[model samples]
Target: MSTTLHIVLAAALISIGGCGDDTTPTDTGIADTGAADSSPTDTGPTDSGSGDTGDAMVPYVPDWSCLGSVTTGTPTAATADVTATFTDFGASGPAVGASIQYCPWDDIPCASPTDTGTTDSMGMVTLTVPTDPDPYWGFVVVELTETRRHEYYTSVPVVNDATPSALILNDAAINVIALVLAETQDYDANGVIGLGALDCAGRVASGMRIELTTGAGTAFYATEDGTFSTSLTETSTAGAWGVLNAVPGDFTATAFLGADSTPIGTINFRVKAGEVAGLFMFPTPDGAAYTP
Candidate 1:
């Protein structure tokens, strides 16, 4: 009986040991879900150089405003007076001696125009329109200026369509066409001789007077229609010799046509001493004075 009991006890102990060996503990410690979340991962906020972590931002703004006359009008054809005034929005106005530019609209390239004038003491600029009439178009641009240092410009337009009238004079009053005196022939004994003639369009008044003043201070008057010749000679008279001896200067010849000695036409001539001079008259109307 004792031996049987020992065997059973030994068998029971062996069975327990086998069961423990079949079911061993895993030793996993903790489940591996992902990497550790150290330092909060920093995903919420980013470094944008300004340290501005907020999502909102401010916008940018511009500095200048356009100021000038933008009105349109019809300007006078002969003379269109336009003016502009510039005032400083800032503390001080433009520096003294600073220049301004003005331009018209029809001008090509519209970059620069011939009609530019300077500013006055009061920072005001004035420009005159072209003497001739221009066709109807958009605004005329006037550019006010500053140099490259600080470039500033303004534009103004003058609008109008009425053309100015031209000056008119009576045609009958314009009788004499031209007056001329030329160096035709020079003589060693006579010094210098010049022929004088009057160019008339219509009938010249009878008893008209023609006066010729030579460069050498020699002067003569003629009442006839054809031609008159005079010579510069050394004389004893004070004004006479002084004029004849001096070098030839500019000569101004005048013609009085009407009975009251009204000036019909006056012409200019360049005379040189010791040279023969010639003068021609064109009785045709609207004849131009020429030098040969």
Candidate 2:
């Protein structure tokens, strides 16, 4: 009976083993499936100088120091192309192979859809601007031949048709020289230097005047006083009388305080393009003009 019982139990165990499912275990580390991965690692290109890698950064160089402009001497119409002449101060002649981009003046980071061009032998480029009832324009020029980045700013007017070249009328060359003349008067006897109606040395003065004379002075904005006299204001709020567009040459500056009969000082100063010359006038002890 015992032997028979043992045989039956062994048979039941064998039957249970045969009924079990046979399947292989899976790996949890790396998935192995029939479908392909939709999101793979990206190995795409990036912009230059983005510092993607943890390496030492390269220094940047400037492409241009200064630039100029040229227009058709007319207001730019919406359908017309606005032309400009760009020259570099560092270069002796025209800037060859330079690129020009037209953007809105308020644009902080100039974006795409930019009208672009390369400078020809004359360093001139034409940009097509869209027509609008009201338009304010800005420009950027890049010298691709040089490794460094450089840009300049100037006004671009948009009109219905080509009128006259008025763009960059006030945007003179950065290196162009200028002159600043200051008048000082001491109202109180305290001897504290201040720009006032009276000379610090206690001299009574009447109407004050400043004159800058040069042949090229007329080319820029000159006063109606026969080019010898410039626009003048009596208030000391202006700080100084200015000759902003003085050409490179000898110039005579005269200042008078008190009455027209009284002259403050007449001094000669030489100016170079792209530089600034300063002149100061004070009353002499004998009521004459002196420059210090």
Candidate 3:
């Protein structure tokens, strides 16, 4: 997604992916990626590093050979049932009457909608889709309008016969979308966080620490209690991991297995203010964000 947002996602209100001036990226990787500098603070987690990003990263190429694909949730028959629930972190409780839809996982922006529905009084909806289930993965994308005063957006990777217990806001995720300071109003009013870790099979990975070799001073990592911290403990997760207060710019990032210096995955992502750019982590040695 060199400049085009490898994991680029565009919204009517916010363009979640892509860089306006990012030059084309030639190659990507690292060997001696130094430790990122971080300071424990109440605002969020921070990781400092000694690299500077200039060239755009190459389009995301999944090295899926070595990294396997998750097989458990694959749909076997045509037209499967997917259960979706929407909840808010603050006082609203559930996202009632919220709009929900089914989109192929490969399309990050959820540009295409195959099936759609509206959440009920309980803040839940079940949508059935055709048998073709993205051929690889299926996702339930949620959009909030007037429900929270600000437009809200979020997606959860799901499968046939499975229902997401809580696609709840404030669920603590590593990726956050904020308004790029300008004339644009910040749309992320609910502080919705999206988890972006996937196992070799493209499933959400358990836990790890993501360090920016040349990025923001602090990041927001989601805790089980549904709060954010910049501490080492928050760098780890049984769910999703993320960071914030990152200046809108290009930077190199490395993922390590909790306190271990060995690099598991290396990625270059761009975070523009007012955009929901994502730096999804994939297993290394084969997949470069896209597992082999």
**Angstrom error at residue 49, model 3:** 31
Reference-based lDDT, each prediction: 0.24, 0.30, 0.36
What is the RMSD of candidate 3? 14.9
lDDT of 1 by residue, 1-292 (tens): 2322222221111111100100111100000111122111010011111112232212112100110211122344545444533322121242234343433433433466545665556545555545345412212222233211111111112222111100011111001111122332222222222222211211011233445543444443221222212332211100010112224445544444334554433344333443322221111111122121
Better of 2 and 3 by TM-score: 3
Which regions of candidate 2 deviate over 4 angstroms? 1-77, 144-151, 154-156, 160-292
Candidate with better TM-score, 1 vs 2: 2
- Of candidate 2, the 10-residue stretch with the lowest lDDT total is 20-29
Task: Give the per-residue Cα lDDT of candidate 2 at 247.
Answer: 55
- Candidate number of the best lDDT: 3
Which sequence of candidate numbers ranks them by TM-score, best first? 3, 2, 1
Q: Residues 65-101, candidate 2, lDDT per residue (tens digit)? A: 1111111122234454656454333343455677667
In model 1, the runs with Cα more than 4 Å from the true position are 1-193, 199-206, 212-216, 221-247, 281-292
Considering lDDT, where higher is better, how would the candidates rank from best to worst? 3, 2, 1
Query: What are the TM-scores, per candidate, against the unseen true structure?
Result: 0.23, 0.30, 0.47
